[model samples]
Target: MRAYMQGGGFVVEVDPDEIEAFSSRWPCSNLTVTSGKEFLFSAENGDILDAATVSRGRRFSTEADDGSALAALADDACRFGAQALSLTDVLAIRFPDLAQAAPRP
Candidate 1:
């Protein structure tokens, strides 16, 4: 995962290869959901700030991708500030069910 501040806003990009590699090893079901749970707990405890406005990006290709993941990251960035986040965080935010299914260590 790549995260940085750009154009006065935060940006996070998860590499497709990373996703594949991680899934091959831990799998979402094998990896524990500690990070996701911790993040949510922190957010509930007032660690996260208010959400920011997210704008839809114009589709550059005819692919069926809806960019919901991108929007989820934007919302988190706005709420959590520019602190570093991980692939698990992204997955947790975008695919809560998968994260919740993560195996306990």
Candidate 2:
């Protein structure tokens, strides 16, 4: 995953094909009554990546591709909410194309 920040906005970019693989590893919500669960992503570098799940309840226990948020991404969310967050080397991403620019691991 690639992360960055710009204009005080958090940004995270992952490969489109990586979504399914990532989601399977990190399940977001299991609520079925039109409820919503939030994801918080924070990294050792103080980078936060946050993405909210689709506003409706899920029919199954599976999470959506876009439902998962990186620990590194949550830092921004925490900060955006005016809450306390801790991490180092923070990076707020505004451009998603960095996903492509990111080095392959």
Candidate 3:
């Protein structure tokens, strides 16, 4: 998807088909349900941490808006495995980017 700055904030575009392919029986947020898609967040200036510097501020980032929070969710799914997670947990944590991109539900 194209990435760029708009009005001093970062923007990320997502493909709807990819979104559905990624999640199936796992429940989605009201936002995702209504929009029928998932979102990813980005920053206008840049990522909070350069991957090379991913260690220093790896904790839950305050900048982790809705879109970015999905990264955390993906992390959870990876770290714990799909069967281990519930729809609520995935829907609860707001990826910064997703939050912004998620159409108000």
Candidate 4:
């Protein structure tokens, strides 16, 4: 299963079972897993940690305006045999020259 975080700059791939397990561990704030199809994670202040969509063998897509926080959550999700890749990393690989052209500070 592949979960894509909209505007979060990363995606996590994990089995559907792992996604269910993760959702079970975290409570949803606004949505319910009626069909075991959606999951939402929010902070105490109401900021979203992650949001995901679950399917036959895939689950959850988390999104947040804060890229750093989203990345951290994605990292945590990886503990369940999930693999994550950042969009920045993909861009660097796809456009090496551009990636290396940035001025060093």
Flag the better candidate by lDDT, 3 or 4.
Answer: 4
Give the per-residue lDDT digits (tens) of candidate 1, residues 17-96: 43344345433333211121111213222223222221242213212222444334334433333235323443466445
Best by lDDT: 4
Q: How would you encode candidate 2's per-residue C-alpha lDDT over 1-105 as one tens digit per residue?
A: 344443454344333334445445556722222333243344433234445433434322224323324442333343332212222223233223333343333
lDDT of 3 by residue, 13-101 (tens): 33334334444533552113212222222232123221111123332232322454345333432222211222222233433433333
Candidate 1 clashes between residue pairs 3 or more apart in a chain or in different chains:
none
Model 3, residue 92: distance off in Å is 26
What C-alpha lDDT do the candidate models reach, one value each? 0.34, 0.36, 0.31, 0.38
Query: Cα deviation of 54 in candidate 2 (Å)?
Result: 12
For every candidate in turn, the CA RMSD to the true structure comes to 12.8, 11.1, 16.2, 11.2
Superposition TM-score, candidate 3 onto the true structure: 0.28
Whole-model lDDT for model 1 versus the true structure? 0.34
Q: After the best TM-score superposition of candidate 4, give how far the Cα of residue 62 lies from its true spot, in angstroms.
A: 5.6
Ten-residue stretch with the least lDDT total in model 1: 32-41
Better of 1 and 2 by lDDT: 2
